[model samples]
Target chain A: MRVNRPKDGDPISVALNAQERHVTFDASRGAEAPPELVQLLTPEGERVEHPAYDIDLTPEEVRGLYRDLVLVRRVDMEAVALQRQGELGIWASLLGQEAAQIGSGRALTDADMAFPTYREHGVAWCRGVDPVNLLGLFRGVNHGGWDPAEHNFHLYTIVIGSQTLHAVGYAMGIQRDGADAATIVYFGDGATSQGDVNESFIWASVFNAPVVFFCQNNQWAISEPLEKQSRIPLYRRASGFGFPGIRVDGNDVFACLAVTRQALKNAREGQGPTLIEAFTYRMGAHTTSDDPTRYRVAGELEAWKLKDPIERVKAYMFKNQLADQDFFDSIEAEAADLGRDVRKRCLEMPDPHPLEIFEHVYSEPHALLTEEREQYAAYLASFEGGER
Target chain B: MTTLTLAKAINEGLRTAMEDDSKVLIMGEDVGKLGGVFRVTDGLQKDFGESRVIDTPLAESGIIGTAIGLALRGYRPVCEIQFDGFVFPAADQIITQLAKMPLRSLGKIKLPVVVRIPCGGGIGAVEHHSESPEAYFTHTGGLRVVACSNPVDGYHMIQQAIRCDDPVIFFEPKRRYWDKAEVERGAAPLAFDRAQIVRPGTDVTVLTYGPMVKTCLEAAAAVEQDGRSLEVIDLRSLNPLDTEMVFESVRRTGRCVVAHEAPVFSGLGAELAARITEACFYSLEAPVLRAGGFSTPYPPSRLEDHYLPDLDRVLDAVDRTFAF
Candidate 1:
């Protein structure tokens, strides 16, 4: 039954209709796992080695990863609070997937590029983007705040599966330039259903483009479940496009780091694309606007809380005697300061002036725009009250 | 001056752009070995090699989406969308991503990507083959939309579009691909955004573009013996129109008629009529008239002759401007 797949439609029905095979939706997992997961650290903080993927991080590096996971969580918490306080229009919280972002983000070489979905605040932290720069976008002060070339990280792409094609194109450009560097693009399980993402897969395959498709399957896309996207595990979909795929324990930073490093290396070596499905869960509401209570049970949340991503890293450090009380306390203090700084900076972001709408619409001098701007400015000046 | 067909002119223009910039690439379906279905990229792969001239898969969204990425990576990728109707499949990339990315970047980056589309219907072809979907892109702010009516404009404007710092939607009339014209390669060419006075007259100012330019000029000659002088103007660029040239002609004639091969309702012709009325309101002899397709899907090709604007319809529209 597993060898001979039926047609797709209602993934659960298709998956169940296949004879003698069971399709189960684990509280945190998407599809039934036929492919073994690469896990370097268990939820209980025990350090384990995968047969195919392994990493030997120095104690200092593990502490840094721990610090990253904590600070990014703090940032996300502050953003959520800001939205509730009416300081931001909305915020998409990356509450549960820190290890997946940081581990994969850090694996990128300085020469490598990353195309990320909007929820990659943790990856932005890894890329050295100022925490304050991210707030500008949420504050509605700018669409994109930081220069991509400055960090080798492209601006957050909001359209699902759109950036994947750009990532492939950039990889194709790399091939043309004969560059050894590779590119990695981040998306959700929901984006796998988009034609652009599927087209990107074909493009990467045929051109032998150096691009890694990193899918952080947080189990939910707004309100829809993973069954709506695929019957097979998302990583397994890559083999149909003629590339290697693997599932990694997204909550385990060591496993994520090891798996991503190998995938990127394979791409740079001209082995073509690799799809790394980082299995994780979205522990928080999708955004400030969504209500998880509408669809899911509280017990699922309680179950996932036991396997918190940051807790596992902290436990691993403690068991190995890698970090002590002072180190953990300092990380906590640093996160607190970052949270306060981001809020202050976000409030201080000036609202763009009305005339600024005409700015940056084009690189060349547009006559029509110039005429419209002048006319609008004259009209505004005529408003008996100035600056209205 | 060398005479060449519109397709060959664009092919030569692409060759010129490639020769000048090593970073320029041509990517689309069948662009490499097939030189495109219209042969607009003929022999380009032979000269530039596979690295620069790429044959993409049969995915419009992929061609355009990847072109955006290639542009971000510092390569000027001139993408071909095969036909006009097929552009809708890639419209998401064009409108949301390609048109908005540079603006979203706040001028920190420039997308020099040029999207080449074969537009307008006169060719006897099936659906999704012949269409004039220019108004959609023209309405998009960050893009520059231009169409070439003849070979020289096709040659010079294509090369110029490649050199611009902005993303350009270049429409090459499919029906006029074999039309021949003299191209003065070394002479200073007018900018692609400027309009041209194809035929000068004192009575009526008729504005048209792309495939309809030839028909409008033919209408002008048809009206000459009837003692009604008509001036035909080809608006090469649609978005930031050359209103200076248009206003000059409209003011002198005191009459205006907008013509195209798109739908008459809410189409590019409507936008032109509004702009002309605003600028030449007092100089007008009548409300700007329009002559083009009806509000319907481009009908079966057997009826395309009735659907597309021809000489009589243009003359009638021009004659109506004298009514007021």
Candidate 2:
């Protein structure tokens, strides 16, 4: 049931004969290749049906997804505003990548593991991590704040593409432990050029690790365009590494959810890894300090305005009778309340004391650290309470 | 008891650790089939199988990053950096992430990973291969840096390092890999962060470690012939320096000289001198002296003999220490 090459044909039958098998490849033949997009809802207030996979969401569940997208965006905006107001040291805005993060984030079960880059505040939100915990990393206080065992979500990795390999390794561990959980690793388009990312792909394909490589193609890596990052389409690049590649409209929450759910099921059932290129745009600056006006033209931003992830979902909800005016008003209230709570938490975060720096260095104890802490404590005590 | 070389001692130490803890794993390039370039990890893969002993891709940062996650899952990983120069790509991970993860977690989580790097320059190697970069790790907090001089310390210290709850940088002096000594495999050995007085003398205290330990001891022997006793102490752990032993020797000898193969400015020698002056200021017979490489890049093989701190250079520092 292990097939390493995408071009191979005989293995498809072998995979079908397996006990947990399901129909994956569509049988419809066409002269031109299928546009990799799978959708149950369009970008402009329209509901469409997918011939391969259909969506049967209840009214409450549909409204819930919309609420998640709006609230996650609200929290994102608050963090960005905090950065501008000198509250945070730095911030990586997940402006247009919300649907990509939230959609894929909500697709996993509680048993699933997730690896995130520095820009995964949206994913962290979906994983039940408080906004304050996310702020601790950007503040000078801590590196990561959430426990992996609790939420099955790892801390944000800053080194470009390094988390991909870690995700692959964890997936291998999952396979060895005979767990039915699949790992999802999130990275940007910029990371796809790194050696670690490519190496992760090769290892994932070779070992058949139950993992998903979710690449958020957010157009600009600081200032470099997607054109500079890759020549061919990003999704097609996955085909070269012996995995099925899919290009989904990252701004479409329904499409993102459906595609990600399918990919995770395939991986958990021992179908190996899949590369998902969520083609989205970086609507905001790369981080708090970045000024996007230097590299990009205003026309490009105007063009992407039509593809706003939240607005399209809102349009669909209003066009259909899935959500009424009361639901929309209540969601707005919730978003405002969440934003206020985040602001209060960010401001009330007490600065860690100097002595707190030496704790948690080792699980047992170190003779050297114990000595240094003692000496450092005396040094700190020598100073007055008001001022050092 | 067995008389094993430094290389074989490390191999045995790794083997013992893997056998003792099922969660302990060994990872590096060429570590599985080749048993490491120096054979320090020999026969491990055959016994532990490919699942436990992993041969990683040619990426240093990748090895360390994944090891961090594995540690989060309650696994102890011992990573080999292959050579001195190869560790730089992982320096970012070591200095920023690995060093900060434990304390940053605020006593909730710990990263008990060991990074074994083959260091120092006397072995006729090309550019980037011969480097002495211990200062970088020693400067970082939340990391314990230690170097082994001979077979006995190499064996016991490695086991202690693995059992330790902290992330330890175990630097193996490449030149001393072939040197042999009888080592004991036991429950516990020397204290993890304490310094060992290799040679006890009185006139002057010579502080050194790793490859320079042998050179300092040789210089001590030569100085003994000249009607002078030189106290040679190996500061095994560099970060949390065994200040008690250092001050004790400096208090007796009254004169001190520090030797290492790294560049002179801002090297481990500078830190040792600063600490000694702070600890034993009144006991000084002369100002502290240092013998180290020049403030430049490691030179060609023909000039490396000059670049490395040999017995003559150490003795010269001793002469300056006494003359002061």
- TM-score (0 to 1) for chain A, all models? 0.92, 0.89
**Ten-residue stretch with the least lDDT total in model 2 chain B:** B101-110
lDDT of 1 by residue, A1-388 (tens): 4664445676766656653233344323435555678899999999886678779999999999999999999999999999999999888899999999999988999989999999999999999999778877777888886899889889888889899999999999888888889999999989999999999999999998999999999989998888767777888889899998888988888899999999999999999999999999999998899999998889988988888999999999999999999999999999999999988988888999889889888999988999999999998999887577
Best by DockQ: 1
lDDT by residue for model 2 over B240-270, one digit each (tens)?
8888999999999999999999998999999
Query: Model 2 chain A — which ten-residue stretch has the worst lDDT?
Result: A22-31
Candidate 2 lDDT at B145 equals: 95
lDDT of 1 by residue, B148-260 (tens): 99999998999999999899999999999999999989878898789999999999999999999999999999989999899899999998899999999999998888999
Could you tally the backbone clashes for each prediction?
0, 0
lDDT (Cα, tens digit) per residue for candidate 2, span A195-284: 778878887887788999999988888997766566566777788999998888888888888889999999999999999989889999
Interface RMSD of each: 0.8, 2.5
Number of clashes found in candidate 2:
0
Model 1 / residue B285 / CA error / Å: 0.7
Report each candidate's C-alpha RMSD, comma-separated, in the order given: 4.0, 9.0
